[model samples]
Target chain A: MRDVYIIGAGIHPFGRHDLSGLEQGVAAARDALKDAGADWQDMQFAFGGSLAAGNADAMLPIMGLSTMQFINVANGCATGGSALLSGYWSIKSEEFDMGIVVGFDKHPRGAFNADPKASGLPQWYGDQGLMLTTQFFGMKIQRYKELYGISDETLGKVAEKAFQNGSLTPHAWRREPVDLDTIMNSQMVSDPLTKFMFCSPAEGGAALILASEEKMKQLGAKGVLMRGASVRTRPQGSFEVFSPSLDVERGGTPTEVASKAVYEMAGIGPEEIDIAQIQDTESGAEIMHMSENGFCADGDQEKLIQDGDTKIGGKLPINTDGGCLACGEPIGASGLRQVYENVIQLRGDAGDRQVPGNPRLGYTQVYGAPGLSACTILSAA
Target chain B: MAELLDKEEILKLEPLAEGLFRLDNGVPVLLGGKNKETGKIVFPMPSGAEAERFDVVPLKRTGKLWSWTVQRFRPKTPPYRGPGDDKNFQPYAVGYVELEDQVIVETRIMGDPDQTLKIGMEMELALEPFELGDEDKYVSTFAFKPVA
Candidate 1:
């Protein structure tokens, strides 16, 4: 099988814009093309990722760019990462030399967006309640803090450091520095989780171009060959409807399952990872992710983050881009955004946010819709 | 969306088995009536691992405030017309109750239509109906009451 690597990564500043989803897709795709210094004309196939917009790929690419045909795919929050997985499968099969995956999202208009998994009737008909996505995680957050005694400050530490780093990055959704007090004082969304502990909804786009080893040599692909690209759904046997146990239900807890598979597939272990990007829609999800993915044992994550172990200079740099908590949560684009950060870290182009010394393996976790989860592993090694 | 029917006439708020409808693994299901329009919560069923008995009382007590909403405008469907001249029940209140055993239940609240409900409130189940009706084929339903 021909080795595949991400040759170019691109994304639009993930914030609200007047442009439509299709326009965002085009802009993001162009950014990837520019980063790779390759023309869209050279593309063999494409996978356009968008969560809500209908049939977005057909309208994104510049017309007559090698007449390259593209396929559209969506996996809810995992849309972009799953798109990356699909692109990898096709490229490694030698059907396509290069593929591009792009995802775009803007928060819903009017009433809070309804959760499709709610099992209840339509919001227009049933009193489903106004569920702020981040706040909806309130139940689990309350339990986790109670179980672990993780102070609000430890959660804030990530916010204080991450958003500051995001502020420096041109593409981050939130660019403001936040202190622990600021985070604690933020409006209460759910018990124990204030507004700052939640990710703000924003508009953004993320695009990545992947090429097979054969194509990379032809295009002079530099740095960070795709050591591992994996996207997975929760095990069918394990998937359940409305598990009352808060621990089992939050964001699908797939980091454990995915990490086990990814490590075996990437031939790497958690200890080998220099940097990791966890999906932290709410501050609590971040810590739970640390435990579920074997980054730390239960309750140990508090010490890990409070002691600065997950920070850039700590034992492992997690969410060097401030996470969704500090960064905006642009649903469709958020998953790919994780990949974008990993790419930048592996490429050593993370600027001031870059970790000390050259890092090697990077892990990205995208857990969502309460149980739909996927993890991608990238290595510059 | 069905019409907001006379919930009292349609639902029979009887205990399915007087807390007998327990999970095979010994988990008990809470049953009761929560006023869909009044936002009142009532628990009418027994919970927890209790032995079968005559005149049985409930053993379970904890529940999570799952989700909630005030009845905005008239309900989409039902025989529910508020106590006004207009036929449309323009505003009411209602939501779901998730108990400790992870049972999601429906309930109603008595409040101004403009009042908002916070998710995860400490709500207990109650026996009541959002819509009242005269003597007919009387059916019953459950409701919820906010625990102080």
Candidate 2:
């Protein structure tokens, strides 16, 4: 209903951290407030979440005891985006002038193990080892490769680029370039997907300060306009993680639905997006999401990746901060990290990984288990 | 009907879970749920409160391989009851098999993952023995083997 802008953004470096998840959240929130030239008292309301970490509202005592409405969100990997959108709606409705959206998580090292019973699935599904997320990625990509003629070399190239970009990103966990051969030859976690192509469960935090246009001008803060934000869950019959069965008739994925909605709300097409950060939970996810998000055709990624067109200083720089591949997925914090990277890219402050040619429009998409996707479109103010 | 009843005997081996499959005329058939009103089918059937909404039906034993991959690493315990550690864990193939016009079911593929599995290949349901983390005890779990 009203215009919202991101006045500031901050992130605690994504990887293993000594600080607790809540502490990391506080740090990122403090950094964002400082960057916005605002204090804790300035936030009228807040929204935040974490997966393995404790309650987000717990940051209140550590920061300052305020009566601000701090709603805790838990939407799988879309936690950060959901928090940001909640803050955006609060401002858009004229209910709050400014607020904070933060996300943090610290997961134990290893592939995430979810309880099948919790998800209402049969226990035998888990007992039989059919509940793995990695296997789902492998199967999905294996099928995509068959139908679209995607080469294993292209999948390897995606990881190679992620590491190359991560080497340039200070906040990235895997900050060294790994060659394509190494990526292709790495221990096969799942067939066609090697260890190097996957993102491990890790820890980190990120935050964003959202304000109405009135507050931004009053504070003299340079803002990034939040043109659109949308989150969608899987429709019936769509393939997703942790499913023991699939429908006979296929349906659209949440990413496709959310991406379409956000672009429509932003009043722009994928071609106009200068910089983009879609979910790269794994190499194949990045490859599939490229087409799902309407950026390119189903098989176009083969050439787009081979020619390095998706690299920095290319046609469209994607995941300039290395995405989940190098950052490691921290669940709650992962989605907001994408936005934080876009903010820095838009401000032209991303030192080495910056997309050249004065990028204007930036887009981000985060997707996770049980078929959920959240998307945002931001433009330089 | 009497001959059909004589052939319709539940396999003697213990299944990983009940109501997953039974033998039909000496052939393994998956038990699926068919929505009483909509005719939509689902694998493993529904249990508990949801069970009342659908009718138990035997699904086709043969299907086409939709997609597949090899589990090269040991999954975490508790959720995974298979016997093995990092050193001795055997890599197994898993994939979705499309059962004609019915539901596509996810199942373990019994074969050499690198050499035998191919997309769109015909597969038939069979019961595979899964170790239950104890010595000499096994349970039958449904899997799809390449159709010769």
Candidate 3:
């Protein structure tokens, strides 16, 4: 029940990196510690998230810190969020006063080659061409469009916003703003979605420093209160990947369940959130997630985009530092990158893409493969 | 029948029904379990370990298309065992078929990818053959085809 606050956050940008995954982790971790004016010895615990690396905790050696409890976490795209949660719980339970959470990844090219057997899924599932994550996003949004009358232009607008924001961001991968027509004219990756709308596999690292309220006061550092942190999986009957068949009368998706839990724990509804960083593996994902995260109605994304409500300097600026759409999706670092952006926005450090108002409350949600979702609420202290 | 033919010969692989579909009077019908307590239905219901009280029942043969997407490109290897090389891979439609509001089966849509597939259109299950490897190795899979 103790309070947790994020004292510092850092990122190694989102794009191809020549350094190894652990190297990237070490870089981000070092920056985070420096930003907090703390040393490696101050960290009582550490959690690392990475998909392509051997073990994120291995970065401990590089930091010259040892004998500390370090756990490596991997939950697909939720890796970063899960790591942050682990660090938060470590402090919340009074088990540790302060900790570091780092997520980094170095991925290969082309569509992610997921292993069904490795993930405990039947070989037949992939053999029948059912395990591709791209197909899942495409199908999910296709259904959303059918039920809600969303159009390709609306989806294109989402990508355009992300790229435009990325262009202004210092560390974004795709820094050039793409035109709406260019996004729409891009080659088809799936029906209703073009190649330009999909996020590419990326290489990057992001890290956060979480400490108790007492510890922050000791350091005399300003920080953001970690009001809520939650992670949830799909309940039965929800339309999720790896689900061969769905119960028509099933339960809620991980995003819905996790968002609700996070809001309840934070003691704030979606209306209080001034900025957001959500999962946008593809353009349509942003559109669908806008509703899933309770930001808007189920079918109101077209208006949300057209009115520029979800853009920077608008009603609710989402992914102001560019999302996975513009940053590229480095599975492990993706979630923490969202938090890093929130921290920057809350601190009023984001120069170009800062929301017009002095945003006080921010929220982040990350959805992973095989149905796992996590969200965290941050408020300026 | 197990002792009768060459391994390379084409064979009707067991349907991917997992006891959910059967050839009843030469017609394929989906099967499911209706929970006695909750009245909830599940297709290809769990066997033995969790089937203490539910009855295995036959599901409706046809339903409407709920949602769909097309695989515009070939998926990666080590998992995808579809026919042909990536260069020759043809786009295919994938969708969910709602079976009488009881269950929605995720299935491959058997139709031309260029054709427009509207939601709420009637669809029926069809057992189809999927060739694997260079030889005659094949597997029988199930897909939902639009019903006239």
Please name the candidate that would achieve the greatest TM-score relative to the true structure.
Answer: 2
List ranges where model 3 is wrong by over 4 Å: B1-21, B31-40, B45-57, B134-138
Query: Which candidate, 1 or 3, has the higher DockQ?
Result: 3
Tens digit per residue, CA lDDT, model 3, B42-78: 7555567577777888878799888888998887766
Each candidate: how many clashes? 51, 0, 0
lDDT of 3 by residue, A105-219 (tens): 9998889887876866656778778778888888889988988989889999999999999999988999999999999999898888899899999998999999999999999
Per-candidate local distance difference test = 0.64, 0.91, 0.85
Candidate ranking under DockQ, highest first, comes to 2, 3, 1
Docking quality of model 3: it rates as medium
lDDT per residue, candidate 1, B90-116, as tens digits?
444554456653335444543454454
Off by more than 4 A, model 2: B1-11, B134-136
lDDT of 1 by residue, A148-178 (tens): 6777787777677677777777787688887
lDDT of 1: 0.64
* Model 1 docking tier (incorrect/acceptable/medium/high): incorrect
Distance from true position, residue A281, model 3, in Å? 1.1
- Cα deviation in Å at residue A69, candidate 1? 3.6
